[model samples]
Target chain A: MPDTPAIEVRGVTRLFESRKGFLFREHTRTEALRGVDLAVRSGSIYGLLGPNGAGKTTLVKILSTLLLPTSGSARVLGHDVVEDSEWLRPRIGLVLGGERGLYNRVSARDNLRYFADLYGIPGGEREARIAAVLERVDLLAAADRRVEEFSRGMKQKLHIARGILHRPEVLFLDEPTIGLDPKSARETRKLVRSLVSDGVTILLTTHYMFEAEELCPEIAVLSKGRIVAHDTVAGLRQLVGGDRTLEAEAYGFDDREVDAVRRLPGVSKVVSEEYGPRTRLTLRLRSLQTSPDDVAAALPGHSELSVRERRTSLEDVYLDLVEEEAH
Target chain B: MTTVEVPRISRSRATSASLRLSFLMFMADPQWLIPSMIAPVVFGLVAFELFRGSGPYYLTYAILGAGMMSMWGQTLYGSGWAIGQDREFGTLEPTVQSPTPYVYVVLGRVLWNVISGLIGGGIVYLVVLAAAGSPPAVPDPVGFVVLFVFVMLTLASVGILFSAAWVYTRYSGFIQNVGEFAFYVGTGCMFPVVLLPFWTNPIALIFPPTWALDALRYLAIPGYVGFGWGFWPDIAGAVATTAIYVAIASTVFKRVELHVLSKGDLSDY
Candidate 1:
């Protein structure tokens, strides 16, 4: 019990070999994870946030014993991942990304039972666990229907049931709510929250910043195989200074004009995207410091500019982080 | 609220669950059950009719050959299909993540398939024997029982071998097609190894099912005992080959699983 760290990963690196291009005959090594050191405390919902290809899933896979790191080491619930993998398997539950985890041909009840058996739950106990999860996910009524006949939400629920069927101490959910509709997304968030309340440690990875903001008590922003930032939601907000973003819609404004506005004093970061005939720009400034005067005066000859100041959110923080990495 | 009851999992219970799951998966599919019963019966009947004038020789040949065919088909396809479905559905990782040992999980599946294979093949062998109206030829009951045990273990490993291929490639269709085709054309399921080329004959003998079929034919038919005795060397070869294959494949499969996990390729399309 003393060995259990909920989940422990230290200096883990994973590299994959791939063909570089048509002309390039030599295979290139892509480092999926690079010397990552992380620890998720017991009874906490840990959010691993990163841009696409930042190796969040790779880290999860390593901890779950699905993949071996090229270097470094990891442990789960006090078991050495390489040496004591068999011991680690039972203590953790994982819902991998994509829709391939559920038996599309079988009903939810049957699928859960199959996993329950795989986990070595007694028949009577397995059935009871299946029923409880089905009810929890509101899939009890449709437990007997083939998963192929289910909507996206139903299949996702069945997957959740499969993951936690063994009641693992630590649960890994990789992009659990991806592609879900608003209603189903809301429901999944609630389910995740409830699981954490039940004292199960959860490690979730997502590109969506707000998803982490809502679910995780502690957040790690992973970019380019490094921990760019790690802190609570409030701490992350503090990293961006104030909690407000300034936006301006200007028609007939050229790229140079937008560039000039970006260079204005007190502007933390600026992003501009063209929408039809108009250019919409958002500037991350120190609260309401960047005013209409800042936009108008900076733009010089542009008179058709309209400016609006809005509060900052996780999305702004995320874009700025990725944008900084790009520069 | 004071909890009235709660469910807890143990190693013994997990094994039973995995076994039950394996059984239910094979049973629920009609495609598996029907073919298993039908092919062996048909082969038995054809063998009986063709060699009626040839006497007990033909009857023994048909029973053994048909039984091996049916059982091998069950073991091979059962393992391939179930594992294929796991990879397809993304349940492979979840299953691996469970507390159950990987050995038990896989063995449960292989053993369940072996039982089904035996039942399917046994029925066919019985049907053919009854039609030919022949008495049992094998004098030693113990030898026959040992043959069945060796046959099950050797043949079961073949499933594990194919499952390794399925894991790395993620090619279910290719695995199924090649497995079906090999049983029909290459493995001597359709015709005896004697009809094949001089070199191919010994190679066919290396598969445990081929030896089991030969033994079954020898035991069930009069005057066919020589051919069954001749197949013992092949049985030894099959057992040896299968053990090596299982050892290698299990290691390989575990490695790939780790690669998929560490690279986070599990979510990659």
Candidate 2:
């Protein structure tokens, strides 16, 4: 137990009893987290990606000591989440919902100082720490204004600043760039990378595949209260194999012909769609069993024959895993 | 994220300063200040006009009763409303997440209510005396001071307990109002407990506001027979009863807080 990882979640489960309706007597205990195990290294950027209602937020809350698991145990920095919460509090900084958690009435400076006081930092030291973090977030000029007046980008930046102000060993950033412009999003990602450089272990949950691929050394795909896959984006994408996914735009493509092509010897998976005045087809295959030529040969008298093996991306892997699990 | 090296201080200083800041923040809110300051003075005038012709004792009773009314009203409402709003706005989670104990936050609210209540009550007393053009025969100053201490401790201690109503209801403003109605009605703020029918004192005695009102009335009036008891005995009883209420309220608040944490609604505000 003493040698538990920085974050060690062991078969944690949460079952919440929710009433279906007020008039009818129906109460259902929905399992938000199944018995799941996850371990984050001491100083690594760990990304958790999932669709809505995947229990990612529930897992984050449990790790932060805000919620207790029903059956399993989680520890942070060698401290049990439930029993040693006091020792854990000072060691973790959490930005649960980005800018939404900020106090709009107070200036950024005042907000940081207030939290510092709560963390038992003295007046002078708290001021110095706030100043340093504000500069890092590039909000030193706007530090005096109330947070309500801050632009969405500025608020997001301040959110990062607040989470890092105390220099917590582990920072839980949940959707840190959900509502930022492209430029602001890029800057936020860069700042997160720098935090990783500073030895702050980051546990980030986001839907943006590109951000996770760029920032997270390791990624966990959460779906319906379970981690379907946990590995590098490359590694997970490889689970779908090295087939070059070919999407073609053509007219008058017959559905039966495409289905017949799927049954052909090299074809692995075929997805067909009808767009405005056009029919589109995407096919995946194992490169070893089926060459792009054999599948192309299967389609005859077609106006166009566009064929390429699928180069798997994180998005592709994520969608495939979720869709496969749902079925 | 960098490892911020914050300067360390003595635990005593940190706790004290946090308490002081909590008090300042509590008093700065308008909900506490406006009603607390105005209610006592307004009620004092109404009482003076209604009971002045009867005797100086009734006038003194009006002043003391109004003062106690303002104390409990401001303390409980101020702490309760502020905590409720913070909960609604999702501010309570961060507060709970902080390294400070829950006791410090409650203490801050208690102190704010006590100081503001005293200030509001003092102003009301001066204005009433000036308007009446005469002062009543004062009782023992030492006993008044003791009574004031008991009232402060009692109200401050109960601040968090009453704040539970807001916590449970998720800041339904009407619910908080309903929860505090007992303080206003049973404490003789709306009507004197002594004027109640035979069976009501037992019920009213359950609240410190009732005794707080009685103690203040005994101090401010001539021929100060306090609930048919002498001065020192009345003072002692007030202190003992207030202490008992404070202890019970604190215990209740702790249980409610634990329940809230278990439910995982600490951040639901």
Candidate 3:
């Protein structure tokens, strides 16, 4: 039991059906998720990275018991998401950050109070807990102000505060730092770290690659409703090629020149892109044996040839995996 | 693994919290009271004007009719509108995701609406009394008052059931709007169901308010002959039908919650 994953999902697929047209209705079925399998360890921050419409939110909704999966199964804390939702509801906190979730006409404190009661926070500790979360999110000063008066960042903080009001064991944060200023975003990340330190498991979906690399020890890249890649950031870098990436640029590269660069030592994979008048060849190097000079030398006779190398980043790995899946 | 102990969920506490929250929201923007009161006031005045030269008991008929109409707005419309607002605010997702069953939350809103409906009914009573220049002759004033409260409860039961439809669909508000007058006619809010086609009586009897209103009129109006059933049968029918509505509401709310979860549209407006 101690080794059991905090969250486990198996062969999950979700399809959405929509109807349009007036006189003769047209029904459209979209596969939002297709056979997604994942496991998030206890007391860890797991990042879910995806492009728009990649089913990250759909997965979160299913795990949080807000939506039933069309097929397969998800379990949180050893409970089936659908069959054991009542038991799972209290243990999980979800923050689908947006302006609409909070009551705009009421004070921030009132919003928390309403959710606190809904979460069944004991009467004796409700106010103190609400105060603590507001303080943690750095919104204590504006607790009594109407939500409509707060900035977007402040509303986001209130959303996070409401999410953690009952001190859930597992928290699902869907784009939590979106629309936030740099300082507020940093503070929110710090709060996320603290929650994990307190033994909370977090499944954070974010577009910010650096945030994911910084906070999550492991991450899953979702693409086209599938978990295209799931590994540690370093592992993902290795999966794509290696820790080093080399880029060559010129007006354009002929096939022979591109092939010549591809055959160079330590080159694992090469991706070519056209930016208007210029072509850039991005090479993933598995070894340090290949230098920038080696890449430049392979494509000789081009006066405008340029080559550069840098350590591979999570963003590079995400792009590689997502782009590969697209092709 | 971190073991999590499930928190205790109290339906009563959730209901009370929902009630308090609704009351706070209502107070924050009490402007809604204006539009809600307009229909009741207009109906009360119109009914009183028509009944002015009739018999003395016509005053009772006008008050009962208009009072029922006012309570109908508050209990049924107000309760369903709360769910519609939840959809608009995107709060329905979190509220549904909470440990407490959603029906308790709706029950809380319905309770608040019941109180407001009573107030609305009192306002109608005052408006009609002012127009008539005197109180209606109630053979049993105490029975009339008790039966009046009972009618509101019957309406509240229907309100609970109706709120489920709002959860089931985003267009429930438009549907309710289209059916508002039909509901009034079907429930005989301003006129007795007996006045409608004799065949339509069975259809009207499906609504608990019909039976409850008939009972209220039986107590307030001296020569009232409702449904050819005596006062006790009407009361019994009202109780049975109200109990049935409450039962159906609980089951329907469960189904609606599951349906929305399946549709994944709890947040859809």
DockQ for each candidate?
Answer: 0.44, 0.38, 0.74
lDDT of predicted model 3: 0.91
**What digit string (tens of lDDT, one per residue) describes model 1 on residues B164-259?**
656555665575776686664556554566667778766675565666545544444445533334655555666677777678667877776665
Query: In order, what lDDT does every prediction score?
Result: 0.72, 0.72, 0.91
Comparing 2 and 3 on lDDT, the stronger one = 3
Tell me the native contact fraction for each prediction.
Answer: 0.62, 0.32, 0.75
- How far off is residue A232 in model 1, in Å? 3.1
| TM accuracy, model 3 | 0.97
Q: Write the per-residue lDDT of candidate 3 for residues A1-327, one digit (tens) a residue.
A: 678999999999999998989999999999999999999998899999999999999999999999999999999988999999988899999999988888888899999998888888999989999999999999999999989899999999998999999889999999999989999899999999999999999999999999999999999999999999999999999999999999898999899988998899888999899999999999999998999999888989889888888899999999999999999
Question: What is the Å distance of residue B37 in model 1 from its true position?
Answer: 3.5
Chain A fold similarity by TM-score, each prediction: 0.86, 0.90, 0.98
Write down the TM-score of every candidate.
0.83, 0.88, 0.97
lDDT digits (tens) for residues A1-327 of candidate 2: 433467888999988775656688797777888987888987889999999989988888888777778889988877788888777777888876555566676678876776777777666677888999999888999998878799988988887887887788888888888998999899889899999898888999999999998999899988899998998876786666433566655675787778767786545677777888777777665555656666667677775756665576788778888887798
> What is candidate 2's CAPRI-style docking category based on DockQ?
acceptable
After superposing candidate 2 on the true structure, give the runs of residues whose Cα lies further than 4 Å from its correct spot: A1-4, A19-26, A252-256, A259-268, A285-296, A304-310, B1-33, B36-41, B134-137, B140-146, B190-192, B241-254
How would you encode candidate 1's per-residue C-alpha lDDT over A189-294 as one tens digit per residue?
Answer: 8999999999788999987777888888888878888776777876776676556677788776677887787777677667787888888887777655668677
